[model samples]
Target: MNWIEIAGHTGALLSSITFIPQVYKVWKTKSVGDLSLYMMLIVFTSTLVWLAYGVALNLWPVILANGFICFLSILLLYFKFAFSRKVIVVAKVKESE
Candidate 1:
């Protein structure tokens, strides 16, 4: 592949993994306190738009990268809600005790 394509792929790989560590950390700790829902929603929306743009332009790098990023972002967002609710439930139980 040409250097340009190589760079694109490299960037795609980097972009795709950005959320991985955060996902793992949150999953392991069951903590979403530091994650911002607004930022996540904005990023998730932007990823969707970028994915659509990439598909329309037939750009493989953008398509593949944004698709994976979309998945990661959604997973993180899910964890945010799930873990936050879990914390609230546990707090309620403790309060009642």
Candidate 2:
């Protein structure tokens, strides 16, 4: 492969791994209370679009990065809901006290 291909693959690898920290945080804390659900929704939606665009254009780097991002965003959305529910429960308990 040429340098360009190498660079593209490298970028894809780096971007894919970048989601690890967020995933770890969500997994460890089971909390995403400070995360913006709306923002993540928009980002997830946009990543889907980007993946489609990459597929249409046959751009491997874009496709790879956005695909992983789509998965990560979904995970984030799940955690956001879970965390929000916990927060609501806590609030109710405190209110009752």
Candidate 3:
């Protein structure tokens, strides 16, 4: 493959794995309180568009990257509603000078 094609594939791989950490963290903590619902919705929508564009252009990289991202976004969205929001309150004690 050419350099440009290789770069595209590399980028695709990176993009596909980008959300794994966040997903894992949320799954482990069971916290979606800090995550924005709107952001996930926008990402899911945008990935859908990218997937359509990629399909139209027959670009495997775009298709794979956006497809994986789309799935991740959906998972996040589900987590947002399915998981309870956990708020941790920290109380600061005054120290004597």
Query: Which predicted model would earn the best TM-score?
Result: 1
lDDT of 2: 0.86
Q: Tell how far residue 91 is off in model 2, in angstroms.
A: 1.6
Q: Could you say which candidate leads in lDDT?
A: 1
lDDT (Cα, tens digit) per residue for candidate 2, span 1-58: 9999999788778878776798799889887877788988997999999999999999
Worst 10 residues of 1 by lDDT: 8-17
Query: Comparing candidate 1 with candidate 3, which one achieves the higher lDDT?
Result: 1
What digit string (tens of lDDT, one per residue) describes model 3 on residues 7-49? 9778779879988999999888888989899999999999999
lDDT of 1 by residue, 10-45 (tens): 887998899999999999999899889998898799
Q: List CA RMSD, all candidates.
A: 1.5, 2.2, 7.1
Clashes of 2: 0
Kindly give the stretch of ten consecutive residues in candidate 2 with the minimal lDDT sum: 11-20
Which of the two candidates, 2 or 3, achieves a greater lDDT against the reference? 2
What lDDT score goes with residue 88 in model 2?
90
lDDT against the true structure, per candidate, is 0.91, 0.86, 0.85
C-alpha RMSD of candidate 1 = 1.5
Per-prediction TM-score to the true structure, in the order listed: 0.88, 0.77, 0.78
Residue pairs of candidate 2 with colliding backbone atoms = none
